[model samples]
Target chain A: MKARVTVTLKNGVLDPQGKAIEGALGALGFDGIGSVRQGKVIDIELGETDKAAAEAKLSDMCEKLLANTVIENYHIDIL
Target chain B: MKARVTVTLKNGVLDPQGKAIEGALGALGFDGIGSVRQGKVIDIELGETDKAAAEAKLSDMCEKLLANTVIENYHIDIL
Candidate 1:
């Protein structure tokens, strides 16, 4: 089974990297850009075949290592 | 309009960051893990409302800045 985990900064958190990208895009002549926020996507291949079991394991992985719960939010998708 | 761009390393390309994450997960006691790849997801808010135009603009942005075509692939989603 394949699973994907997306880790994003929570609302109200400052994202300097996103700001840098936004500035760079403007400099590159892209216009009408409102905001830019960056996040992480992790694709994992698991030996587990059960959909529910894979999702549960992915969630545990997110809580334990993939994300910092205090400032970032994580979503798991079983693919 | 909201757009999302996901940039990922091409197959056969070496990803040290991904290897590091895989190792970390193994150390953290995650079992039955296979290959792990990491990528970037950028969420952008565009002033434009037309979906087709927004997608075209995003494709251009990906070509010019978000992705390295030689070793990375980018997928754009309009939401």
Candidate 2:
């Protein structure tokens, strides 16, 4: 099975990387940007073919290793 | 203005970071995970209030400074 997990900074969190992107954008003359927040995407390839099993494993993965819940949130997408 | 830009490896690209995350998840007892692909998110704080301007600026940013089009793809979200 294949899945994607996206982890993002929570509201009000300070993201220096995001800030750098914004600055770079301004320098490049991109005027459509208002604000920019940054996050991460994790894609996994698992051996499990069972949908329920994959979800369960991903849940465990996120809670234990994939994300830091204190300042980051995650979304799981099965593909 | 604030916006969020996410940069990710293009399809078929090799992502060592994503592989590390996958290994971590598995070591943590996530059995259902199929795979993990990793990407980065960027946040921008723009001084401009015009939507069109921000977008244009952001577009330029991604093309020149924010993302490496040869290996990565970027998405913009206005907030």
User: What DockQ does every candidate get?
Assistant: 0.93, 0.55
True contacts kept of 2: 0.87
Q: What is the lDDT of residue A23 in candidate 2?
A: 69
| Regions of model 1 farther than 4 Å from truth | none
Would candidate 2 be rated incorrect, acceptable, medium or high by CAPRI criteria? Answer: medium
Work out the TM-score per prediction: 0.98, 0.74
For residues A4-74, write the lDDT of model 1, one tens digit per residue: 89999999899998999899999999999988999999999999989999998899899999999999999
User: Alpha-carbon error at A79 in model 1, in Å?
Assistant: 0.9
